[model samples]
Target: MEALGWFLFAYQVFVLYYFAVLNFLYTTFTFFGLNMVARYARELSELSLKDLLEREAYLPVSILVPTYNEEKTIAASVRSFLALRYPEFEVIVVADGPKDRTLEVLKEAFALVEVDWVYRRALPTKPIRAVYRSLAHPNLLVVDKENGGKADALNAGLNFARYPLFCAVDADSLLDPEALLRASRLFLEDERVLAVGGTIRPLNGARVRGGVVEELRLPRGFLEKMQIIEYARAFFLGRAGWSAMDALLIISGAFGIFRREEALRVGGYRTDTVGEDMELVVRLHRKAREAGRDYRVLYTPDPICYTEVPSDWATLRRQRNRWHRGLWEVLLAHRAMLFNPRYGRLGFVALPYFLFFEALGPVVEVLGYALL
Candidate 1:
């Protein structure tokens, strides 16, 4: 009994140490994130943005939206993309064989007509059924493809993307007018930046008209309203900190831009995992570091993409489960990088953080509760 008591006391000390280290790291990140965000905001002012446009330095971008059973939100989302302030961009909506009326609604809303599009398949994806061109918006193209997951749909879109840069977005989300311009500017300013992640806000309470969010408001549901706060904290602090350090491992799947050639060189999104976004980003970091190439993956708060949050408990639970599982999968897949000097900060610091604090957070929480 005495030995067991000593063991318990030691375990308690370890837990306390773990908790302190985690909070200290979070605090440091928060400070770094705030500074980075402030700098980004100043650089993204109206004059700077206008000058960027006038200089014609921005690269053309292809927006790849993967749709699945999204009949209600598909049209509005596409319209929002159409109204972005970027100089040159094409909206490619890949309908991932939805069981709902997603295809029909897109066709009717955009006056889509089947077109003969011939392009090289740079990446292997599920078979595509047909391609459509919209009469209403010349820049919009819709591809009806076989039933594939989000990553697969993105792969299909990647196969036909013509631009040098590609932005991946969810079909149910709405982007701010300047979202693309803000996100794409990083790539233009620095040749080393391979990818940039943008901020995503909850769209549950926003008023939408003509594909634009007219007003930003708190969501009606308690859960969704809480999520808004959670998202703000994560993006404003967590991602910003990582970006400032140039060790950001994950760019969100909801909205992020990537250099086309770099993404293709890394084999696009991995279709096998739920955490494809993080996996792709990690692979990018690994590949770049392994090649001895000077490169950066960034995150900025200026680009805002609003997406609807799951209000009900069941849906939210499933979402959280998927996220946790994905985090574990990514960490396991890249376990070789942990504590390795070769990957620098990514291996020595970031990977370990995700492995312990994030991947095993739930277990720690459970243990703490049980101890109490």
Candidate 2:
């Protein structure tokens, strides 16, 4: 028993040291990335919005929203997307056989009328019941599909999407009016930029008017507050850091834009994993690199998407569990990239960091607590 205790103590010490080192590295990388983003934003903001609008430089985008039993927030969420400021875009809402009145509310609110839309199945998904286009909003389309997971719903949307650029957003998330504009700019400015991820802010305490977040304020709930801090650190530091290194791994599912052709060429979103967002991003990188193409997957700070974090402990834990599990799934799915030199920075740095810290860090911490 005494020997076992010592063993555990030693493990705890090692894990703590590992955690400290990882945090330090991340902090350093974050600082560097923040500086880069500051410089980039400054240069970008100098450009005339009128010039961008006039040139029609922005690519048309298809906003894919997947919802499951999200009746409470679905209407507001769709409205937010529809209100986004962009040159040309369409909103495809996928109702994943919600057990609630998700479809009913959508039909009634939008005055949806069934339409004959043709699409080729690029990725396998459950049977789609029907496709409806809103007479009220010409850009709004709804797909009634069997209960597929978020990934499947996204896949379904991809099939019906008719744009060069596609963005996947959660049904409960609210996008800032300029979110799409800022995110899509990367693709226009840099011909090589395949995807761009935007920052996700907590929507609980934010002031929303006309389906747009007018202002951002810290949420009153402790969980929401913690999440705000977490998101800030994750985006302002972690993701920005990775983006600077040209090795971003996970683009937030809440709001991310990708080239439709590239996403489809890579076989679209994986239905087997909950972390389909991360997996798809990784696959994009892999595919891009293998083709020896000078492609970039970037993270921009300005495009903000407000999403509701889990307010209760149970929901929070479940969400975290799902995220962790999804990370593990992606890691396993791309096990080839682990420590493989051919993938360059991604193989040496991002994959290892995620494996050690993001994937296994919790287990190490939990074990340390038990041991102590």
Candidate 3:
């Protein structure tokens, strides 16, 4: 028993040491990524707004919003999207068979009328009951589909999307009016860029008017405030670092833009995983590298999306559990790329970093606490 105790103690120490080193590396990567984003944003912003607008190169985008019992915030969210400043775009809201008045609220709010539209299955999904077009908002379409989780619902949205670029957002999230225009510009500017992810901020305490965030204020609640700091550290430091190295793995689902053909060719969103967003990104990198294609998956800081963070510990825990599980699922699904030479930086550095630090860091911390 004494020997076993010593073994456990040594194991805990080892895990703690590993955790520290991994965190240091993550911090390093984050610093680099953040600098890259800052420079990119500055350069992008320097371009005259008139020139950007008159570039004669607006790419049509389809915004896919997947909702499940989001009645409380659905109207505001949809209204926000409708007000986007893009020249051409469509919003597809997939009502994932909500038990509440979600569908009814949308129908009445948007003056939706059932429309006969043709869609082909790009990814396997639950049965879609009906598709509706809003007479009020000409570009808005809503689909009533069976509850098949967020991933499945997004796949359903992808099947019905008509644009060359598709963006997936949550029903409770609100995006900046120019977010899409800023993020999608990279795809147009660089033919090799495959996808672009934007920075996400917490929207808990922001003042809202006409479904747009009128002001940015720190939340009064401790939890919300902590998330605000967390988001700042994440986007300003973490994602920026990863983007610098071109090893960005997960783009926030709240606001990410992808080439429609590339997304479809890579099998769209995976239905079996809760971390479909991250999984799809990893697959994009894997496929691109495998095909010997020169491509870039980028993260930009200018396009901002604000999402509601859970205010309570219970809901927060549930969200974290789902996210951690999803990370594990994605890692397991692509275990083949772990240190595989062909994937270059992704295989050697990025994948291993996620496997060690992001995925296993919690377990290491827990064991350290147990030992103490």
Candidate 4:
């Protein structure tokens, strides 16, 4: 009985220590993030962003939309992409074998016609059924393909992507008119930038006109309001902090731009994992570090993508499950980079921080709650 009491006391002490450490690290990150956000704000204010747009200095991008059963939002999302303020861009929508009428709706809405275009299969993916070019929008292309999954669909779109730069976005998302211009400018400014992640805002209760979000408003759902606050904290602070240290690991799959050549070189998206976005970003970091290349994967707060957040408990639970699973998968898969000095800040700091605090955080939280 005495030994058990001693053991329980030790466990309690450990939990307290863990709780304090975890919160301290997060608070540190929050401070760093706020500083970075302020720096970005100043940079944007001083920089002549319009000069890049007017002079057409931004790189061309192929926007890849991997859709499963998004019949309702596919057309509007494509319209949003088409209306982007960038000088040169193309929208590639991949219908990943939806049982619903996603393909038919896209065809009817956009006047899509079959087109034979040659593409290099740099990465293997599910077979493409047909490629369609929209008569109504010249910059729009659609791919009908087998049901592989999000990663597989993105691979198919990658194969069909024509430009050197490509942006991956969720089908149920909408980008700001200058989103491409803002994200692509990072690539132009820095030769070493391999990927750029944009901020994502919830799209509920916003006044959208012609596929563009004209006015922002708070959603009626309590869950969505909670998420809006969460997003503001994560993107504005956490992501900016990571970017400041050049240790950003995860770029939200909802909106991110990558160099096609670097992504292809790394064998494209790994289809086995649901956290394909983070997996790809981590892989890029690993490859660049191993190759002794001076490279950066960045997160910018200006380029915004609006996505619908889960408004109910069940949907939110599923989303959180997938996220945690993905985090574990990426952490385990690249365990070699955990603390090796060779990978610099990534292996020494970022990888360890994620593994200890983020990945194992839930376990610690549960232990603390139970003990309390």
- Expressed as tens digits, the lDDT of each residue in 244-334 for candidate 4 is 8889998999999999999999999999898999999999999998999999999989999999999999999999999999999999899
Give the distance in Å from residue 345's predicted Cα in candidate 3 to where it truly belongs: 1.2
CA error at residue 356 for candidate 4, angstroms: 1.6
lDDT of each: 0.93, 0.89, 0.90, 0.91
- Candidate 1 — what's its lDDT? 0.93
| lDDT (Cα, tens digit) per residue for candidate 3, span 1-372 | 899899997896787789688778867977797678668757776354447778767799999999999888899999999999888999999999999999999998999999888988877889989999999999999999999989889989999999999999999999999998889888888999999999999998889998999998888889999988888888877787888888989898888999999998999888889899999999999999999999998988889999999899999999999999999999999999999999999999899988888888788778768766
Q: Per-candidate TM vs. native?
A: 0.98, 0.95, 0.95, 0.97
Per-model clash counts, in order, read 0, 0, 4, 0
Residue 144: error of model 2 in Å? 0.9
Measured on C-alpha atoms, candidate 2 has an lDDT of 0.89
Question: Listing every candidate in turn, what is its Cα RMSD in Å to the true structure after a full C-alpha superposition?
Answer: 1.0, 1.7, 1.8, 1.4
User: Per-residue lDDT for 146 in model 2?
Assistant: 97
**Runs in model 2 with CA error above 4 Å?**
1-13
Q: Which candidate leads in lDDT? A: 1
Report the poorest 10 consecutive residues by lDDT, candidate 4: 45-54
